[model samples]
Target: MSQSIHTETSLPIEREVQAAIQGQRALAAYLATRFETQRIQIFDERNEAHQIELPTSALRLLVDILAELADGNAVRVVPVHAELTTQEAADLLNVSRPHLVKLLEAGELPFHRTGKHRRVRFADLMHYKGERDRSSEQALAELARQAQELGMGYE
Candidate 1:
């Protein structure tokens, strides 16, 4: 499923929501201890109960999501194979659309064209982002090293 990046998806910090999320997080943490799968019961407003089995991995993911929500952080789950428009990719990378297009044109990032529009795979975008972040860190380290060598008082 495709989602437009323009929509607001941030978590709300309302007290009631926070309380409910905290309770759910505690329950998820309890369920995460099960080895193979977890059997949980859900009760409706009418007191009707339904039982379901969830894999331990899925339970663990739920625990993580709930924890983030409890901490008032926005969370998104993007499939690795999903294709994103340039604007969406740019938003994810915290860059402008024109800059992302330039990267695509320069072959710094891979993209596929459908008609006249370019699409980037989520996995490829993440790979490029990781490399860019690592390169930036190395550059910062080198600059610090040079300043120290010159006795620029960076230490």
Candidate 2:
């Protein structure tokens, strides 16, 4: 699998599509609650009908993706073990490519060189992101505590 599986750009969902997604999402969630797997029929452009079976987990994932689309958020599904280029990882982190490189060099995030190009595993990046987020939260909590102790008008 390649990281290029993601959409190149986020596009606005049309009203009709959004409405259909909402309806389908509701039905999928309902089915997920009642069954371990679902049989779905799909129609092609030629009006030919095809049926397939999907697990409850897939239905739940579909519901979540639909929910994000409904909320106008771009969603990218990256496999945990997938390798990402520096630019792709940077985009996921919402940071610049140079910043991501800095993190890789500083060992804040781990990456392996692929013929002079760096590749970061999606799982490692996510782990690093989680740790960074927790550290930030802790630092903010400490700052709040200090402010309260000093009577800095911060509750």
Candidate 3:
């Protein structure tokens, strides 16, 4: 559900916004028919959705989102970052800037110093994620095996 606007013609922007939110083919058709205005700038729903007037090229994006929603597809944006600043990297790793600097200092992981600041590669973050996932999987497997041996649940 999203709030709509009628800043342009006072015809009924809310109705159009409602159509977009519903994400049905009929709704999409209604929107296309109603708002002859072009260019809709859509942003990630993480914080807030701000509206901006876009050119006709943005129609493709609108169509994609509507189609995805209509097909019951989860609309999510994966931040496929290839590189990040020291602060961003620290945030990703859930570590403080100082601690990350310590890792860089200790030569534990490879990092590039950009002038006075440092940057971490996304590959390193991916590697760390894989290692953590493997550890979690191993722990879960062990727990399941232990439960089975102890006859914890009914067969």
lDDT of 3 by residue, 39-97 (tens): 44467868666786654434556676656555544453224556678787787678898
- In the range 33-112, model 1's lDDT, one tens digit per residue, is 63788788989999999999988787777777767777777777778899999999999999999999999999999999
Q: Which ten residues in a row have the lowest lDDT in candidate 3?
A: 3-12
lDDT at 122, model 2: 96
The local lDDT score (0 to 100) that residue 81 gets in candidate 2 is: 87
Pick by lDDT: which candidate is best? 1
How many clashes in each candidate? Answer: 0, 0, 1
Candidate 2: misplaced stretches above 4 Å? 1-9, 24-28, 31-35, 46-49
Against the true structure, candidate 2 has what lDDT?
0.84
TM-score of each: 0.74, 0.79, 0.41
CA-lDDT, candidates in order: 0.86, 0.84, 0.65
Report residue 91 deviation for candidate 2 (angstroms).
1.1
Q: Which stretches of candidate 3 lie over 4 Å from their true place?
A: 1-81, 102-108, 151-155
Error of 3 at 3 (Å): 30
